[model samples]
Target: MKRHNAGELPLSAPAGDAKRGLGKEEAAEQGKVDRYGKGRVRWSRLCFLFAVVSTACVVARHCYDAGLGRGNSAAVVRIDAVPGPPRKIIPIARGEPSEEPRHRDPPSPPGDDATSSSSGSDEPDDIDDGAGAASSSKQLPSPSKAAAHGHQQAGHPFARALAAADNKADLCGGQYIYVQELPARFNKDIVQYCDKLSPWTDMCRYTANGGFGPLLRGGKAAFQGAGAGWYDTHEHALDVVFHERIKRYECLTEDASLAAAVFVPVYAGLDVARHLWGNNVSARDELALDLANVLAQRPEWRAMGGRDHFFVAGRTTWDFRRKPGAHAGWGSTLLNLPAVNNMTALVVEASPWHLNDIAIPYSTAFHPASDEDLFFWQDRVRALHRRYLFSFAGLPRPGDAKSIEGRLVDQCKASPACSVMECSTTGPDNKCESPAAVMKLFQSSTFCLLPRGSTDTLRAAFDALLAGCIPVFFHPASAYVQYTWHLPKNHVDYSVYIPEEDVRKNASVEETLRKISPEMVTTMRDNVVGLIPSVTYGDATSRIETTVKDAFDIAVAAVIDKVTKLRRGIVEGRAEEEKLEKYSWKYPLLAQGQKAEDHHEWDPLFN
Candidate 1:
């Protein structure tokens, strides 16, 4: 790929041209930038004037072109169009079975370890396996000869074979991964100050186990699986999974120059959460701004304009894109920053329109430690004798009259067979917050109500899938649209969808669920069980032994695939000014017969 100086930004479009054809839905989206009743900001005409002052073509054109919002401000700017061929869509070989590893005889050591970047540094003192496990160089597996080739070995079959191995080697691949050794302030400093980060909840629980949080209290007995060591942790802590997993990633290398993609391990979500509740935009944005400044100074940023770099944000994309003049918003200005705009961002919930933000699975309960545990849980769920036809586990939101969760809660409460576990509790832990309770609720029910939460989707949907219950979503963004790379292409294969408007006006949740034949429900449950491994973000300690790939593996592979393609495009001067967000794990679901209108729009800003 032809490298560009990061300082040399591409020309941008005029800001005034951003709102040429503004629509009602988009205007409303920009107008009331609600942060789920917290830090709600009203961006009116007056604010537009202020936003114009700070408006650069990069931000304006990106928002407008990406369909996030309309730009009404007369922000001065310049635009440029880099010529390229029409993009040729490439099919990704995901979830395809690969042959077993054919281990080769060790190659002779190189004359001089030119790429041995960490040869002088002391080896790891102790490998963190939750328990203090003594790790030595002899115990650690050496990188395969193919991995030493760095970017050159990206899609090699030998790497794929290693990843397919039924042992610890399953996590090993030939593609070299480099985790940036970011300054302490970006990661540990933020965690050390967790107590002061949030006023509503204690941040300690959310930061445990490298951000996957402490494992659920009672899961080993209920769900039989070996190495449940880190399988089931707090569902909201996705930042931890990415941070720790890459440390043990099979392809990880110490040499940055010998890496296919560079991972910046900054806990952006936890950093911004400290200021989400208060109306202090600068305070909320402090860490992110600092991060951008630090990253910009790095040689890697200049080498590829941040294109070959990536990071994981445990929160939604909206949480990091605080508009210029907005009075309040839940997040910082991380995504909107010029430096970050070029990088691949793996977020739990991504803006459907944002090109660089890839949607990943929200951390959920029932994280299996190994393939044995995964299959055992799947078998139990498949054979579960569900007593209830449906279930809903949430508290009614009294504020929003048209709240989907409120409506679902009411419907479930009224139904004779539906189980309801109202989330009305306080303190560190409660039955409502327990994974056991949540799992039991779904296990006893045939169908689980998965309405839109603060965001388009919630972590509970995966929990339901783990318990062998089929999820019924009101919004397409809730699951079908968001997890295109992780879930199956056909929605009907594992889930049921009833539009919110239809359910609010005429349809009965119970009646709709009952209408489905028992056989179909059984089939859906089986499908859901089969998909558990793909969506579940397992404990970092567990080796992904299942033939089925989990969320973390799929996401990492996708990023590498994307970065490789992007570099190839740049090198050939055929880079398309578009994204592969619409691509799916299999066939595009929309093209498979579902009506476009069925995909109801939802707010990415809410959570």
Candidate 2:
């Protein structure tokens, strides 16, 4: 329960000569250098990364867990669940049940004006849920109180560093959440050993979600109840505290103690009432400005480089997949886009709303996970084929080799510039019979029949382009937002975009292939091969990074990289405070919902 690490740092003690002449300012400065200076920092970092792989010493085991807890500190309890005493669980009384969820932005209660240097408290008023469970002036046992009750051990260096980081960097660095201190209303899955890593939401708390006050101490309705953690706006954060907790406060209020902070990340919903308040407009006007105002803090906070506090990017947006009668809608490949920002990449599965309306409009999946890399081509080609060929022209089923062969045969006969070419006599499972045969058969033709099959990507496009043959795409097209906008659309003028619907609407595959002009095909080929990496993956080709192992590594990396860079940038004078890239509502389906609901996710990035 001690507030500071009086036991001292874990590294080799400095010689008497090292500390001989330094004063307070000098001590702090040297400490900063020891912590983050180039070589010193690198050595220490290597040691930390090594610890992840080599923590075998029993003594080191205890120390490591105590130090490297969650995303908060390098030192804390190990995240791996180790059985220990369970914190006392207090039962929360459920309020009146309503299908309308007990979700709303709660306000923080006023704190005692007096400030405690060590505690750094402008302690919020006790919970006033019609039951004065806590008196505003009630004093706590201080750090010694928990020790007396055997609730906690003395503050070790790990705990100290964790607290220090949380205090100093909560706004932009990391947050420290001692979940056991929370009432049972919170997640029961929290491990006691601290070093465990959990989802961002699990460790993060805000005024909306009964943060800081109610869960810290005192009272019946404080935590074990509904209407908690519904904080809806920035103004409401008037009471949010970082790193430390104080005596009980009002139920569902947005106010709480102020601790050291890095920045506040908001987990927001498209709530209407709070949105109105933020906009300087009244609620019934259907105001979204308030929501924007509250969210603006995220970008503004991050952009300011306020080392003490900053927002994590502008804001993040998410919505459930709307597939009817479907229970599990996992992340669909349709969400991938090249060079898109973090907020746009979501776990949205295909739904009726997107059955045919949405196209995987990404140029490339930036950091292609194995699944994405595989799905990128296969699904894309299949979708295009389904839309343009089978469905559009009512052709034979996808597996009809005879029908496919017949189409190619017809093309050879119909086009004067074409030759009877065969990748295989067998049919659709055909390889480019041989590159030599490909050159002899397709090299003279202005357009080549670029059929995309097992290798879903447009490998045919590559061959056709290289052979001076224009590719007429009936396959999956890369949906990159950047290239399509920046590059010329005629980029594919010589090529053709025979939509799957058009193909379905057509008469015969032979007739379809034969109608295209050789000159047009050649032009299309020119553009496909001339495009940028933004146009394709694999070769016209490929995507991205160290964090590729996580399920959605890009999102996590975005958050981590932004935070790390912002911190380092501030020191280097390279960036403004928060300035995290803002992602528009990237998905058309999502945008449709946003427009319908008069909602937007990238509120912070906008005005």
Candidate 3:
């Protein structure tokens, strides 16, 4: 439970003389003293020197291979902007520093705090000291140096690509996601926010990759596979999708002038979860209110009333929209705030009624590095001689009167052809918690049961698709009404819909599944495989090429496209009247034709 400061190294054991009783702090300080200056050579110092030498060697070798920080020159395109002058596009040699005097916008300054006091007292100290200004500006890191530094942090495979892209134009039709450099308190420092999300359990593991959590076991030979990709499982960790995607977004740029949309990387999901159980309204809403206030002062907000700025949440929109006097309940009234309502909000489970709330894909287990890896897995699943007709992998909710999970569990357990991975029989050996085990079950079955979870959407559906198993849903809201962008226009093509009414009436799920022809099942499975790429989140550690669009690509493109249209509307003075509508008529509502009776209550599923 100890909180460490930013950039502070954790304590390690002492190397020499355990009987000397030297404290860790003393040992660390002693390791830095020169032997010639009133001290003998300490073992710690020698170890430190050795580590420093090894790191330097690795950095040097990497830079050499990358053709960076060397005299060898290449052409690079640079954008030059001066106050009250027309911007010019000029070509310059690599490593050649520009002399036109770099002027950065107020919020874009390096290492600047995202949240500062209104008096502006926390402004960067370097701004006022005229004596060191020019020299300091000249010392600014080049693209090569930045890449080298990025490598040292974690050796992210995309560091080289990031360096190579220094001169490349934004590929998002010139749109870029301007990531806010907020203070640790807003995001990183508060990762311990995980520990307080709920009262009983410690949730620190969910905070990895800025709250994305750890990578999943991608495949049997993921590390050795050709075009191998990264995969991770955040089964209950929905917030991780936004955290990882924002960091890996290709259109991300630090330059404000090139930015079409800005991302406020507030760990809002974690921030609000900690306060949900507490009854105090002010306590639940403190950070959100602060975020709205700080963002309002930014020049970008003043320009468009925050229409171009957005944030993503791992939870549902309802979790943050608790209204006053109506109910003393869980969650904060964040979405109800005036400032946040003006801006867009992407949630894992969006409200069907909210216009600004965009429903994005929940993070699944497969995070492939390349298209080849994805195709390889898809082929493997297609080749699987599935033994089970259908499978269900979930815990039974016996308490809920509306839930059919218990009945499905009973039917699945009783059926000879079904492969059931029951979570209700809790123990250390529960295979349901294991990603590999769950994937194996899905791959062995023709269809994976996806009952309605506490939320409308569940990560299990995405998992089923990733494993090349057709998802069988009982509710239209489960998949048909949600994740329209990543799914086929015709839900019947990729999934099976057994209406809740039929299940409630004790209709046979096994009989329904057995009726489908083998050819039809193969077609449905193929359709599910095709959707793998779109629903999968790529590895955050590397930049891998994929033929099919991934979730990150789709989300970025959608946000930019909507922002562009909205900006255009505003320019024409029709901002208020303009609304972005679903344009998936290209894939007409095949769901309607497939089952007219099921589409009665959920007509939006057709749209």
Best by lDDT: 1
lDDT of 3 by residue, 1-607 (tens): 9988967977765655642776878766666563444444466688899999999999977776666646576533345753231122122222344333443233322222222322355442221101100112222233454334333322111122222223233233234566655667777755755677666545676566544455554546322343234344454455555666677665555444335667887878777777777778788888888988888776545434666678887777778888744357767888878788778887877765556677778776666666667778788777778888899987788788888988999999998889888874545577775666777788888889999867778777887888888899998778776676778767889888999879999999999988888899888888888888888777656655546778877877787666666544433335344332342222223443453233344555335
Better of 1 and 2 by TM-score: 1
* lDDT of prediction 2: 0.30
Angstrom error at residue 496, model 2: 2.1
Scored by CA lDDT, what does every candidate get? Answer: 0.65, 0.30, 0.64
Could you give candidate 1's per-residue lDDT for residues 1-607 as a string of tens digits?
9889978979865755645556778756755654533443444655876778668766866776665564465544446863232111111122232222222221212221211311232331121111111121223234553233322323321222222221233233225576766899898887898787677777787677766666654555455443253334554467767788777665655434334578999888877777788878888878888887787666445435577789988888889887765667667888888778778888888776556677788777656667777777677778868889899888777787667777777778888898898887466455556776787788888888888866777888887887788898887778776777798877889889898888778579888877999788778877888888888766546564456678888888887777666544543346354434433211235564644334423332222
**TM-score, every prediction:** 0.67, 0.25, 0.67
Model 1 Cα shift for residue 427 (angstroms): 4.1
Candidate 2: where is the Cα deviation over 4 Å?
Answer: 1-409, 413-417, 420-430, 433-442, 451-457, 474-492, 499-529, 532-607
What local lDDT does model 2 show for residue 519? 63
lDDT of 2 by residue, 1-607 (tens): 7566857847665577667778779988998887677887789889998886675576556666677434465655336654232121111222322122221111211221111111323332232121111122223223333223221211111222122222221221122111112222112222121122222222233332322212222211211221222111221111122111112211111111111222233221212112322322222121122322332233222212122222211111112221223333321111121111212221111112221111111211121223344334233222221111111111122475423434545545564445554344333344342333343343455445544343223234433433344455553232221122222444346455444444445444445555766565444544543432222222111223221222122223233344344333433336453321232223322332344234443232222
Error of 2 at 250 (Å): 53
* Per-residue lDDT of 350 in model 2: 16
Per-prediction count of colliding residue pairs? 3, 73, 6
